[model samples]
Target: MATLAHLSDLHLGSSASAARTLEEAVAALADTELIVVTGDLTENGRTAELAAFDRITAPLADRLVVVPGNHDRCGDDVGAQLMRGVRVDVQVRGGCSIVRIDSTAPHNRVPWLSHGRMCQQVLEQVDVALGAVPDSVMTVVALHHHVVPLPAEGFWEQVSEVLHLPNHSELALGTELLKVLRSRCDLVLHGHRHVPRQFIVDGDSARPLRVFNAGSTTELGAFRTFDFAGGRLLGDPRWHQVTPEPRPSPQVWQAPVCALQLA
Candidate 1:
């Protein structure tokens, strides 16, 4: 079995608090075998912000598997340049096959939209990559946008709902992506909503696909770890919290309950 540390939405360069939170979280991940970051490494995809991210994560670079988020593609194409235009990156590490997909909306087409979509070309790439992976290995798909809908848990999320904002925090082609991933991948990991959640998507003739949405590691002081063996999750993922400073009293927190199951 192998262990994977999942982190998302660091939003570095957004504030000093965010940087501190990420530093603490990274410090706590000394024992993890592999680290997976879903996206939003920066608040505005600026060169300086990317540089800061590189500096902070330098120690963990060898084991990190990352993909770009909407925020990472916002102002400039630096994120894309950094990633070298590879939309589907497949890596086999520690007995697990990880497929990282870029789900950010095209900046040239939708400059102002926060919603993400997987184009036909990207979907085909995903299909080809998954087809190449052996069935014996545990398969995982990581991306920036949530394929499954999550509840409005934060203040901004609630406000967006109240305003009925179109395409706010949405994956425009998520259902189509789900159709492609449900039967092929054992686990789907993402972090766009900044709310930690887990759910199962059952396929008609294949095993259920487990989906985990990681909360913001920097903003919400949250991350998770999962164990996989024989192409299955071992147990409930352990939820962890990182605070900028030590609290006088130890605080208790529970993992977010699975809100929805799709058939």
Candidate 2:
């Protein structure tokens, strides 16, 4: 079976001390057919931080898939460099066609915008991109924003308050995008919460879709290794969290058995 790697929230300049973790992650994912990065490439989207990450991921450039997080958009370019390198929506190797959708809010001046919004045009573009996929291939939809509110409260809330972190989701969550996505795709991946989670969304289609957030790859040293064949994921999802210590975090989340569980 072919393996796909998912990583997110590098927060490069912010998490620069995790240099060893970055090195290990890149080394670990070197063998995967595709590596999906769900944004937060830098602390504030600085050129140097991007360069740091680019240098770290240079080995996997040919197979890399990425989307910009709010932090990455803080720079003047609005993570334009990240999008520039992603030339195709579908993989030439086929089997899996991953379409990247930008969920970041608009910010022309000083890149002040945060949170997420899909907009009608973005949804239309997402539709057009999916049209390029073949029916036989499995589809993976990726974006920087979480369509639904994730559990980020309690102590985390206080911490965020202290850190001055803004609202995690967009002022207007484009649930319409989720409704549209639920009908067609097999898997949807996103990461902005800086927390790793696996969830099931019941779409109009009989087959429920899987959603995953890999957390902060560089800072938290979190990442996922997926076993898939013919564009469909196989068995349970096996995710790993690399810690600074000798011990690492390994977690498994199985596909839900009951449809109501999703509801």
Candidate 3:
């Protein structure tokens, strides 16, 4: 089976204590074939913050894939240029297709579907990336901001002014992009909201797509491990929390969640 390590919302500058969490998470991910970070790598998208990320993930450089969140574009430094958006389509071990899409822009800080033109272009880019992958392959699309609302409806509504479309047409456009990807993929992965979620889309009838939201590793104490084989996705994800040791503790602390299934 092929294993992928997924985490998001590291939010490095949120606190100095956050480093221990990063170290623990990275240690857990060292063995996976691919490591996917959904977004918000930094608390404010500062150069030093991003640099810290580069250093932290240095050992896994060749296998890591990352995208930007609203926070990554809001601060002083130009992160887009630093990361070059890190958008690309690649094949994972066991022949699964992995597409990393960049949905946020450097100048656009607020989280919204207001950048319709850019969103359309990125969607088209995703389509092209999928087309290049063989039909027999299992596919996983990764991004920063979530395309669909999560269980935390009340919280999302507050940011809907910048995130969701006020009208159905705009909403349709945002969804259509995902629908197109669903046609050729087995799963979708994203993170922006700090809460963990799993959304299964059965609207296609003929093809079912599972969207796994890895949530925020630094903030919510959540992360996932996926198993795949050949070109098919197999088994449910194993989620766990990485607890931080007290300042005086001599060694790092780790926690395991026995009941990790998500509907």
Candidate 4:
């Protein structure tokens, strides 16, 4: 089976101690085929913070799958542009197609999400990436947001507050994105809400179309691991928390189900 390690929400340079989270995650990803960093690479898109994260992840630089998070684009220059657009990074090795899509919101801190409509555009780009996949190769989609609603338990409450601040009607959700995804893909992986979760959108009995979201690596120090064979999810998802201590915080929440498979 081919194994991939996933992590997200690394708010680099947030607090002086946040670097420890990066170290813990890097240590955990030693043997994985590839590393998927969903988003929140930097706290405020500061060059200093990005530099710090770059140094930390340098060991896996060649094998890294990177995407921008809301926090990473809150600053200036290239960081701002990265937030407004979606980036597609494809890795073709051993005949497997692993695509990383940078699904970050626009960098305008007005009301709700800045680039809600960008998801559609990103999906369009993803279609092009999928075309490159061989008939027998596996395709994995990576992003920085939850395309599916996670369990309520205070997770969405915090997100709702952040994304819905100063505006309250529509939210930048991923349901529309998922509807499109269900038709042409094998698995969707993402992270942003700082909670770990896995759900079978096409039904539990299904075989390949699965959605996996990794919890936060910055605040929670947790990640997701998946095993695949011939583009099919072949084993259970391993959810692990990597903090030096096992203490829990308000940001730390349990996933509904540790793992799932969708067809």
**Best of the two (1, 2) by TM-score:** 1
Instruction: List, residue by residue over 140-225, the lDDT tens digit for candidate 3.
Output: 88776666533333444556645545411122244666667665887778776655666666643555677766767776554678
How would you encode candidate 4's per-residue C-alpha lDDT over 1-263 as one tens digit per residue?
77777788778878865788788778877777777787777777777888898899888887777777666667652245443443666766433567776655454332234332244566677777777666466667777766644443364455655675422212254665555556456677776666666766555544346776676676666666777787666676775667876435534445554343222
Off by over 4 Å in 4: 77-89, 93-95, 108-116, 151-173, 204-206, 247-254, 258-263
lDDT against the true structure, per candidate, is 0.75, 0.67, 0.65, 0.64
Ranked by lDDT from best down, the candidates are 1, 2, 3, 4
The numbered model that scores best in TM-score is 1
* TM-score computed on alpha carbons, candidate 4: 0.79
Lowest summed lDDT window (length 10), candidate 1:
246-255
In model 2, the clashing pairs are none
Q: Kindly report which residue stretches of model 2 are placed more than 4 angstroms away from their true locations once superposed.
A: 85-94, 108-113, 153-166, 170-173, 203-206, 244-263
Arranged by TM-score with the best first, the candidates are: 1, 2, 4, 3
lDDT string for model 2 (1-263, tens) is: 77778888777877446566777888877677888888877777788888888899899988888887778877654476666644225444325778887666445223444566667777777777777766556688878777765655457555665676655443253566656666467777888766567777773445567777776666556577777886567766665656654223333222233222322
Task: Identify the candidate with maximal lDDT.
Answer: 1
- State every prediction's TM-score relative to the real structure: 0.85, 0.81, 0.78, 0.79
Q: Of the pair 1 and 3, which is ahead by lDDT?
A: 1
Span of ten consecutive residues with least summed lDDT in model 3: 250-259
lDDT score, residue 228, model 1?
A: 78
